[model samples]
Target: MHVVQAALVAFGVVFVAELGDKTQLLALGFGARHSLRRVALGLTLGYGAAGLIAVVVGAVLGAAFPQRPIEIVGGLVFIAFAVLSLRRDDDEEDDDHSGLSVGRLAMSSVIASIALTILIAEMGDKTQIATAALAARSNPVGTWIGATLGEVSSGMVGAAAGSVVGDRIPPSVLRWLSAALFALFGVSMLLGFP
Candidate 1:
């Protein structure tokens, strides 16, 4: 029951947070060049690896610190994430490919290239940090599963639909929605509501 609940919460938080993120834009770019299946696979693998690391670290931190303090800190972190989410400039060009030549990669290298790109991008990313915070307050296994799925789902959507989805839904709308969810989570944590 705890695992299921944690998974649901983590999924909602991460999925909302990752919408319109740079990695999703990367997915759009990559999917344009590579097979959608390959992109989805790469996204799953990359997010899974990152999610595992985050949950492990979060679990360790949760074990080390008192629950109340961890909750307070996690709440603060979520609030900070909310503010940061709103501050991001949506109009910035997303042509930066992290110097990876997407066109030159061989068929076999596509998955690896995409996976490596996603892994690199996820380092210190808001979604990763949020996953860690959620894991600290919930079940690590569930959090990892949910976070990985959430990230991969968003990326898959990007890969499948291209920029159409982004174009259809204004970035400001996603940003506001994500910010609201983060703020809600933060407030809930601060209030000691599980």
Candidate 2:
């Protein structure tokens, strides 16, 4: 695939994967309670690290699987992500910590907390897995860059919205949009968009 196409595909898929995700909600909460810049920076760094690792693994896997099969698998994975996103349970307890202060705002505690929380929350996440799959089928560098940007953008948007709007958007809308995007990508990839 072309580098631009690879990057675009990874960006779109990963962006959609992040909507209404647990990490996004965390970013929202962090934004409400802490500095948005620190939260965004931490999210960017953590997501970049995750994207790098996932892309590396995908590149390794690419060496093992041929292009055609990898593309097919990536498509299937997108579809599965769509289903999972639509079916996700939203009844989980909120872990809001607005009452707890981790020290002065100038300290690195905020960054550390956001980074650690995101890193742990993103383990085996759909976006990470999708980044790996995209790398396997396309350019690993493009996939990594795109996925990293997508994750950062998602975090920033979520944080900004959450801080300003306080989750006024309905979760169902995000789910439907995510599902549609995943299905569209999956179908196009399966049918060979190129």
Candidate 3:
């Protein structure tokens, strides 16, 4: 695929994956308590760092393995992601920030805290894994850029809309949509559709 096409595909995949995710909820919570600018900046930094790591590892793995085998594995991984997405509980509580007091932190501290929290929370998250898988099959640089942008954009939606977003869009709907997309991608890859 062309680099731009890869990036666009990655963006769509990651963006849909992030909708109704816990990290987006975190962004909503922080947005309710802090400035949107800070929340956005923090999310951008954290997602960028995580995306960089994912793509680099994926690039290395892609280079190390034969292309056909890698595509097959990537397809399986995407199918697994679809199953996992369906299995996620939509009613799960967002209690990750129970201990932190955002009011007491300075501006820079708030940004750092948010960034660190996201980085830690997303280290092994499905989005990161999906990003890695995408990089393994597509253009690593494109995947990195698109995944990072997708993550940031979804986070920004939560931050901008706050709790209103939660009230409007059902998490289950997003989950089902995301699962379908993953399944489609997996099936396409497995069948060598592209």
For every candidate, C-alpha RMSD to the true structure in Å: 10.2, 10.2, 10.3
TM-score of 1: 0.59
Badly placed stretches (over 4 Å) of model 1 are 58-105, 163-194
Decide which is better by lDDT, 2 or 3.
3
- Model 1: per-residue lDDT, tens digit, 1-194? 39989999999999999899867866775554445766887888888987887787744644576767656775776677668657654223323442445433443365775686677556556798899998878888898989999999989887887545545666676567656756776787688764
Off by over 4 Å in 3: 58-105, 163-194
Question: On residues 1-194, what C-alpha lDDT tens digit does candidate 2 reach at each position?
Answer: 88788888898899888988866865765565445667787898788888987888644644565656645765676577568647643322222333334333333555765675566455556787789888888998888888988888898887897667535545566556656756765676578562
Candidate 3 has its poorest 10 consecutive residues by lDDT at 90-99
Query: What's the true lDDT of residue 175 in model 3?
Result: 60
Model 3 lDDT tens row, 78-186: 6776686576542233233434454324455667766865664465567888999988888888888899999999998988876454456666765676567667756
Candidate 2 accuracy as lDDT: 0.69
Model 2 pairs whose backbones collide:
none
Global lDDT for candidate 1? 0.72
